[model samples]
Target: MLLKDHVVLITGAGSGLGLGVAQYCKAQGAAVIVTDIATDKIQSLASEFDEQDLLLSCDVTKIADLERCKDAIVQKYARLDAVIGAQGVFDGNLPIQGMSTQHLDQLFDELFNINVKGYLLTAHIFADLLKQSQGALVLTTSTAAYAADGGGAVYTATKGAIRSLIQQLAFEFAPEIRVNGVAPAAIGNSQLKGPKALNLDHQKQSDIPKDAFLNLFQSISLLQELPNAEDYGALYAFLASKQNKVMTGQTLVADQGLLNRAVLTQSH
Candidate 1:
């Protein structure tokens, strides 16, 4: 297995991409520490994991919660091989022209807090442990960073920030730890929700009509199918593994060829 004998931490693993990657890491023989802010999700995950794995209600944006998680990990395994940051929020795809100043202000804070700040805090809190192990940090960005209409303005901006953060962190932590990012195009099972500022928190990317989404996605990219969460698992597993010796300070575009063509040529 790629990650055999490793100890990995996955944040925002209550559902969606985080959940999928956590399971894949476990199957690859890593002792996984899965955390999310949802208490019910944590409770539900308990039965699937033995005492060997740690599950907690961790809010990534809060230092105290992250510190508690770090202490528990250090007490249990004493070493962390990789940290996969998978928590994020969608910006409801509402263009800036449609939003008022108040809407934009609140939306920016909410999305950036969860989507950008969460990764920043996680990296800061866990840097020492990862450095000790000379491990890896795999962050999640999006195809929005490269192309237009991948998300709304705020969401795209947050992703761009993450893409830059990956490079900076990789450079700072170099010769010891690897920092990288995965920018996925379309995840078939994405539960990425929107900001509460515009009252769009109830909306999720996963709620899209499957057939319509598939048809639109298929028409644009060379790869006709929308990749499922598990399909991206192996790539994450590899990046978080010791086998990643050469690559660093980069964001791999796992976009299934979506950005290669004129997918956004007609967008205003």
Candidate 2:
């Protein structure tokens, strides 16, 4: 009941972390509005939630669609207590050398469109409502934000931009609203290993060298299990809760201490 009586609007709610958060919020007593571009996926997902009161078709990359999503939430709930901008994409693992300018440009545009631009637009559109509720924004960045080659040129930049955006939003929004982000390690749910539209298994011939990935896991410490989308829901819930009022403009690392090990001494 951490979020009891609150209204949370989440993007990318069709699947993965977004879907998980929506459900978590609903379970915690929040009226949830789940929005995603994939209508069919979201509809199917909605069935799983059994909360007919939550769900919308929002393409975060499209301003009109985002506006519609926001309007729907305001109409139904009157105000938003929290917003989670979780619509993002990792279009397979392509290295800088292997990537064409066209590929990089297109991917960069799309990633920022959903990740950075989406967050900005959602914040602006919901800021007034959030101010009324003293709400917060929980953005989903990633471990990729901290490393130059964590994802790829495009993904890294997009995540980094999101990291900065969290701080900026927290500063601009001030005491009325809080802003924060979570940086997770590789969650093993990326569409990167799949087809052309990230639907097929392309991991067999991924552009990122296998050794680079192996080295990352080999050096990791803490829990051995792979991180999952559902694991993020609780963290998101906490950040969006009233208990976290003093915590803002910070990025929480929930990667099983992956980054901590990165900088830790071997002796430790």
Candidate 1 — which pairs collide?
none
Taken over the whole model, the C-alpha lDDT of each candidate is 0.91, 0.75
Off by over 4 Å in 1: 263-268
| Candidate 2, lDDT over the whole model | 0.75
lDDT (tens digit, per residue) of candidate 2 on 186-258: 6535333322333323342234465665455556746666555777788999899887867999999776766
lDDT of 1 by residue, 1-268 (tens): 9999999999989888988889998888889999998889889988778877899899999999999999999999989999999999898889999999999999999999999999999999999999999999999999999999999999999999999999999999998899999998888868888789988788888888989888888877778778888788898899999999989998889988887786446631
Model 1 CA lDDT for position 188: 89
Model 1 Cα shift for residue 172 (angstroms): 0.7
Best candidate according to lDDT: 1
